[model samples]
Target: MTLKHILLGTIGATMIAAPAAFAGSVTPAPADPVVATPVAVALTGDWTGGYVGGQIGFGDVDAGGSDSGAIGGLTMGYDHDFGTWVLGAGIDYDFADITAGGNTLENMARLKVRAGYDMGAGLLYATAGAARADIDTLGNDTGYFAGMGYEHMVTEKISVGGEVLYHAFDNFNGSGTDVEATTAQVRATFRF
Candidate 1:
């Protein structure tokens, strides 16, 4: 072959072999570093706080000897939350026309101290408080109450609930005795 043609052939062979020499030996160029932007979340917090609400209660009252009547009225209260536990105290006032063995009561007031556990879906709770009832004759006075309740979160901003309670009162001036009573109620609460 001519020298020029030989030189050209050598150059072509060198060019072909150069890429093969580098095929497995070269490191790929580093990819551009990716920076991710943080995303903000709208809602995050412990649903533990103080709440105030009013409720209507239905209860039976036993004041005089074997006395019973339907009672209902208003309730106001506040609650404190620590994670899944709730501690609360409240006062409920009710009025009922109660009569038994020639006795009648006009207005009754019952105060309660309550505590509960939040099971995520609802609260399992118990309450105890003071009860006082009034009669036209001499203002019959007494104290007693117990209850178990469940409060459910029906919405993000509201809660609806139900409860069953037992009550007792002592008429110190009338018969020197305590009487048994029962109660049930439905309630709703708004959250902020």
Candidate 2:
């Protein structure tokens, strides 16, 4: 035979006999579906239900006639979650060292409302409420506040966050000095 015919015959013979020569030990692959074990994940903390916590922070309040340096305060609040809506109401007390002449300021209280969403990792919220703080020169000036905050959960029962608030104040003591106050604070909350 010619070289080309011999090579072709060899290739044809190999192809025709290859499958049967290996058939004695050839095993079919399993056709079963893969079963993955379900993993169990722990839920750390839920931002639902009634929550009460206290906070202390510093703030500056300017009421046109006088400017307050640094104010210290305490706060308590309850927050409720109705799935998509997180509703909260709280109050705070602040003692400010603000005086233009010779008057000492007393305690300031604020009643606030909050609306927010708990986005798995943290709680993102916006707050607004009526605030009234005592002044030496102007008595009590009532105002409103708008702010935003993010609470990162560090544990099952503890979270820390920072927030900024803008306050608009009414004129006091006929001074026509409406004030805008902004405060930034780091806060830690204990969840029970």
Candidate 3:
């Protein structure tokens, strides 16, 4: 065979066989493995009942001067939860012995109205109401107080919280002295 004829024949044979040769070597890519993602579960509680609790903390009073001491008290209230919002009324009492400028403060009481946001198993709240304070020799006076608190449910019937309050009594006991007090306390409550 001549050189030109031999080269032409060899090129034609390769062209016909190229597709089948590469086809057998081709592969399909493997599909990605299935994956599962985790989801978080939300906590919920119903706070539509009566609750009673006890609190203990420190109090600082400014009645012409400043006096600070330990104060403790008992609290009772009823909460009605409206989905994410809660409203309630409560009454509490604290026994204290703080002396300011020779005046001894004996005990205090409050009639409170509370509004809060329900945070699943917890409640973040604000409180305001009338306060009655008794000071030795200065007698008793009525005033107003506002505060904030947080309570978390520990069990179906028990919860714990902390509160900080500001109380103001202008012209305390007819003495023309404005009395202002701040108190911080921790509380534990039982639901009924």
Q: Considering summed lDDT, which 10 consecutive residues are worst modelled in model 3? A: 38-47
Residue 135, model 3: lDDT of 89
Best by lDDT: 3
> What lDDT is reached at residue 30 by model 1?
82
Cα lDDT listed for each candidate: 0.69, 0.68, 0.92
Rank list by lDDT: 3, 1, 2
Off by over 4 Å in 3: 1-43
Task: Between candidates 2 and 3, name the one with more favorable TM-score.
Answer: 3
> Which residue pairs does candidate 1 place in steric collision?
none
Worst 10 residues of 1 by lDDT: 41-50
Q: List candidate 2 stretches off by more than 4 Å.
A: 1-45, 65-68, 98-106, 173-175
TM-scores, one per candidate: 0.63, 0.64, 0.77
Q: List the residue pairs that clash in candidate 2.
A: none
Error of 2 at 178 (Å): 1.6
Clashing pairs in 3: none
As a whole number from 0 to 100, the lDDT of residue 135 in candidate 1 is 66
Error of 3 at 136 (Å): 0.2
Model 1 CA deviation exceeding 4 Å by range: 1-47, 52-54, 65-69, 174-177
Report the Cα RMSD per candidate.
8.7, 8.7, 8.1
